[model samples]
Target: MTTENVDTLEFNPISAASRNGGYVALGTLGGKCVVLSNLSKNVVKLSPSDMKEMDLKTVCGADWCDDNYTYFHPKQEVMVFDLRRLATDIIRECQVKGVYVESYERKSGVWLMPDGGLAVNSRKLWRPDGTVLEHGIHAERIYSASGDIGFDLDTPAANDDEVQCVLNAFGGINWRNNLGAEMLLGWFGVAIASVAMRRRPHMLLTGAAGVGKSTALEMMKWLSGKLAYASTGPQTMAAFYQALAGTSRAVILDEFEADPSRRHSRDTLEIARMSYSLQEGDEGIVRGTPGGTARSYTFYSPFLAACINPAKFEPADVTRWVVLEAISRKPDAVALKEAEARVIGPRLARRFINRWANFQKNEAIVRKHIIDAGGDGRMADTVGVLLASYWTFVSALPATDSEAAKLVELLDIQDRIALHAITDEQRCLEAMMSKVLPFKFMDGIALVTRNLSIAEAIQRICDDPTGNLEITMRLAQLGMRVGCVQGTWRMFVANSPEHQELRKVFGGTKWASGGWSTVLRRLPGGTEGTQRIGAGFGAAKVTIFNMPADLLPANDGSALLAA
Candidate 1:
């Protein structure tokens, strides 16, 4: 390679083979490999031609099949080379230095790394045509060759008694209104049993303080076989991954705190996102041969679950996870007292262990529903399953109006919060209206007006009369004579009953010419003669001549002025 191009080439040493006085293998810039060695302290590069003269017995190590190794060095970047093609002329001439290699087997048209050794980097498992097969970090190992590697899952006999036991352990006392807890149980119980359609069915349980989230998780643990529990925090990624390695179908991540350093809550949401898919890794092995001792690693299972407080989670998190909110309220004090007196935790656990099979069957049904719904079904169904499963736990709790309303609001707000499409003031007003308004107000109108439209008008009315009176006095100011006269209130616009009715409604009066004279008398400018002339009155009771209907065209003249 040219000197300029050499800068881009990466080299890795195959540690296991090289440590045994073997030729150090190297991966080329273009993902090819070569071997290098030191002969009498003079660094000697070994090409494919050199390999023919060298005895296989004399050589400490040789790049067998590139498929057998993957390279990952802490200092240099990682790459994979196909040793099966090592005899090719292109690979024969390449200088392999600072390059590492790992073995892989082509099985079912897919390349798989051997047992006891995992692919150092998951991205290397791609098709010969360069299509990436795996995209994320391999957090779990799947061992196909090791018959001894197995998962321990509890298999309770399938029967109604067992089912009831599991249901009772999951807090399934009754079915009505225990939606959240029931759904939680279905998800967790089925998930622990490894019955989820997807390899990973992450459960997220959130609720207010003093609610039984942690306690419920503890109960689940007692119901299942040995489970690994990890308490996640802002810096728990390493710990979380490490803990995930030890378990098969179940992992309880408790007290997960959303890192505040992020712009949003749930700093490790990215990790949570990846857990939806399965990952592969290698397991280490120890073998002794006449040549020397060898160590290898392989891949194994993927299944995990997590629980977090709602305050520490973002709305977007609720979408990816099966979310269950726990409410702390005792529906029936007497029943709760009796259950508490009975020490039901152990009874519940016993029931769960008994009905584990039915839980698995029901989980299968739920998984089919999820698949039928086409990848992450609507949030309601996802949450509904959990509520249905844990129904008995919260059934005895009396429902509070505030709690019910909060649940409804939470459901509605999720769409907005998840999408970030609502204004802060609108959210505030919703809270206020929900608390203060007796009658249901139009949410659309409230959103459009921002609660300020009517609120501002009302405030002004209570603040100043002159400014406020304009709202009530606009019609009278529009040249409509409106007031009381004699014993009745009247409003006259061309001396019509329509005007009179309007007058009654508005509490006003109107007359032909006499009323106009009475109003003018109260005005700044008025003369006795002018008043009498304007009034046209000649009797004890004020009277005025009614103008002919068409004396002045209705369109052009005021009937009072014409009279």
Candidate 2:
């Protein structure tokens, strides 16, 4: 059935063998029989009808083959079972004799090329000494969207001046302070060393339009070279997972506003939350596929976002981001040049890659220093990697002892600010207090209408010994009660109308739930207490937050009301 009909058959096994260079095998993937061969780079999944046609070229040249092989075949129908058996026998023979040559597969990130050079992406490879090569090398086998943007670095020497472009571009953002600018610089370090680090932190560059958000994104593209997937708008979680699959390329999403109310935005936030730390044996974000099977997506890359309107996230999600707010360009600020970013981005990336071994060494030291300076585990990780990365970049630069001390002092200040930063609970408390509600006085019955501030009404009632029962009753209907407890004034919060209203602004946060007692207790100067503000309500249990000095009884209880 084989050689006897080889002359008349549409597909000849002998001819197919010769065309394939005698390199092919049968392998199973996802419980489906597939043909693996050196003629293609991926597994070839053929249909039963195609097998009936005995299409040797289509079957062998499927994505499974690494190279193209010519095989001519007629359209005549063939016995599918016999052909399958013959193909199986050929694969078995090839396997036994070791005829197939498998291509070496490499992960998509900074990797060493076969020629002892470093491959940063599809279009660029650097020599051992951080110099760009004349021709590109196929250093990676994984498919990536970032591979389309080729790296065009030609820096003969990747020196401090070459990397200074990063500092200069970041400087253009008009950061609120030196810490924010320095943190952005450190983020560049995180992007370069993303593949090597176990925990890659994320960044959010948020501000008003014309505040250099897009420019910052462009700078990220330049610094990342071929190791970044830069998007101009918001994207779904699936898009991010697909783009970052099997690669450590930094994800830069410009104009990425994550509204927690929307399902898609929530999913995006969830992705960022989960990507912060990669614990050992951590099974990545598991999602249901079209076939009802679970697919795991592991993102090793750092996520960066730029937006005008920042989205509110849960405490867990907020801690994962090193939020850097951008400001209007100062009148005296230096303008960043695109030409410099284009050239210097690749140079900075090369420096980071070439000095990776040393960066790791310095990062450990910096992490220890951060932890010693009152930073928690997460803070240490986020700020430590950044400082460590910056130090790694400028360590080669000649500096005085004072200059080195300045860097240490900067790290100490950043650590202190991070440690004392406004927490999510505190933000929620402030938001709730700032929320304005109306209270109109009518005899003893307070109408919940207008011309009153919530803080003012609370202060007025607490200061008046005559007992403003109307305002107290109004407060009760809104799920809250405010009065003076001893010398300190406190506001009692419960599950009511105010709770639901606050939930709208603070959704996806701890304050969104009915468990206000536990959350409010975390606020500064807060405790559990009972307040009986109205009749028939016998000392209702409530979470109490003490009014701060500013809100405490002013000289006539009119301080808050004046504004």
Candidate 3:
């Protein structure tokens, strides 16, 4: 009942006071029943009701330190200190020698390995416990299976025939390099890049059902072990936020296709769009409850998917994946069997990991080289790691490796691909915008105006010619929101929820939108605003873009799909 009997009580008064350099006693000092003091800190005397609000009994340090936060476990368990938020004391009592309170807190949602690194599974991370899981989902760290062997190319050296056989099943060495690079990313993607460079490209194996798409993914599954997952993968943005609360390397969304039966596939496509830029600072907010656990979850993970036609994938999402179409369209039964039999799965996986790790070791040098060779600045690390992965498998003999020499060549191809894609997209956008700018809208219904009197939106470019690309780039920057207001598309820059302008434009509007940055798009009949439209000219799905207006389909303007 009194501070004098603190030793007899479970709470250690001396330790608590020492931690914050303050005295917390149940004796009146300011005409109050309790006195709490810290060195030149806030002095608040809590009455009985106020004590409950402060959760006083749980206070270990000062009156209110880290009282509200619940830390994560490496295995995705949500937990808190035994004495409310007094993590230090509980960790001290845990008697797990050498483990700090922060270590157990899993603040990073990643395992800070005792070996001095991090472990992530299923894009999920946790506090390190000297072990990591060997399988994805529900499979926590495989005890004693130190990431020592699993994430490295520790396999016995295979002969050319053995390696070539595996290569053949994966569409030969050409496909192998690209696929192998992407597959290894499934394990280390989230960990290797900084926030700016953290986008981990996904993988798509497209082929007829029996063409062995599953077999290719199975090969990846073998290499990845616990990091390869086959679940639906954060089915909704809310679920995506929840998923971010954990760790993972790669996720598999199999048989990926837009559900033809549905009116729209917003959930599916939004999830796909998200896969491209699921890093810490991306725009999507999780949990409807603002400023809650959603604040703690940041999304980043690689995806490996198989589908007949990734009909639902957007061009933006398409670029985020390394597409590998099955060469044997009629179902390569032989190749399927070979891939599943672990012919080169184990060795190839090892080599990829080891080489990728080596690239990371030489990250500075490799990154410089890629940039010098004109690799896309945004994906420099990606190209460097991919080239390193290719060279590692091409030959152990560095001198004989044309693969290493091809780093420049590969990067050249990448630059060309990027340039070509951008050029094509710009042409398409110009055509669409040409049609769009002259259109007249009343009550949000869009119709082409007979006269070209309304200033062409192209004037936006003439004002700041550079601004056109800036606007275009911003549109494609991972999570830009182009909402459909009635049948008209508006770049929903919900210019800050605090702005009266935003409230005026978006207030009570039932718009189906993604991220607070977007205005929620409201469809007729109270439907959410996601739709599936086929993208042509090799685009896996339709995308918002910038280009020459002359190239846009004469009849198509801004709709969810071009078709």
**Model 3, 127-179: lDDT tens per residue?**
22323343221221221112332332224434556555555555522342344
Provide backbone clash counts, one per model.
Answer: 62, 11, 46
* Model 1 lDDT, full chain set: 0.34
Error of 3 at 17 (Å): 24
Lowest-scoring 10 consecutive residues by lDDT in candidate 2?
1-10
The TM-score between candidate 1 and the true structure equals: 0.35
Q: Top lDDT: which candidate number? A: 2
Error of 2 at 174 (Å): 4.7
Which sequence of candidate numbers ranks them by TM-score, best first? 2, 3, 1
- State which candidate has the highest TM-score: 2
| Alpha-carbon deviation at 335 in model 2, angstroms | 7.7
Q: Which of candidates 2 and 3 reaches a greater lDDT?
A: 2
